[model samples]
Target: MNNPTSGTPAPDGTAKPLQERCDNLMKRIDLLITIVDRGKGDKIVQALRDSRVTYNLSSVGYGASGLALVDMLGLTSTEKDIIISVVPEERASEILNILLYKFDLDKPDKGIAFILPISGVSGPIALKYISGLQQARP
Candidate 1:
């Protein structure tokens, strides 16, 4: 029997180890995730660009507050935009500030943003695309 589920085969029949496969997904990167009202994704993306955070992606999604809120609104779900961006650690704070102050996220229901720390980074192509590596300055 060919144990296809065991691992991912590169080219030949041999399966790549799980650790090796996971390594490809790791990157010394931090992710900034923002959830905003529908049609507000552009604002988040613009802020990232303004902060020089070049690598980012935005998508539409639905937000569920809770059963009570859902009942109060008489709606099933609230439309929202989810923006994900891979940023360097040093720049995360500044980008977040722009999204908060400039975009008025501090106000209620304006939306929220947070940063998730990444442990390890791999994949040459992704690294190149993100360009997250920082050159030491004197």
Candidate 2:
């Protein structure tokens, strides 16, 4: 049998498969989801756009505060806007920091943001969208 990975053994002393090596060569992608008070999605999206982020989405939701005090204060069902953005892992931290300061997310009730590591992506369109490489392709 022939090994396409050049017999390079991963740290565990076992040769990694060709497919894994190919995947590792590709850029890593991540998803950033931010939940903010209603009417704030535009700000986040605009900031991302200004930073050259090409792909992002937003949806409406309601915050379910389970605290009795919140209920008494009529804060149980607060309108929320969920914004989701996909970017390469290399730029995820910088983008997150921009969001944090731009939206005052560090303050209480301001909003919340998280980054999820993507295992794999399929299709050239999706890859282009996430990788922000939409140049001419044959």
What stretches of model 2 exceed 4 Å from their correct place?
A: 1-25, 135-138
Candidate 1's C-alpha runs over 4 A off are 1-28, 66-72, 75-77, 132-138
In candidate 1, list every pair of residues with a backbone clash. 26-121, 26-122, 27-120, 27-121, 28-121
lDDT tens readout by residue for model 1, 63-93: 8775886668777548999999988776788
lDDT score for candidate 1 against the true structure:
0.73
Tens digits of per-residue lDDT for model 2 on 1-138? 343345456657766676765444465789999999899899889998887777889999988755878778995558999999887789899999999999898988898999999876785457767667553122
Error of 1 at 133 (Å): 5.7
Per-model TM-score, in order, reads 0.67, 0.74
Candidates' C-alpha lDDT? 0.73, 0.79
In candidate 2, position 123 carries an lDDT of 55
- Candidate 2 vs. true structure, TM-score: 0.74
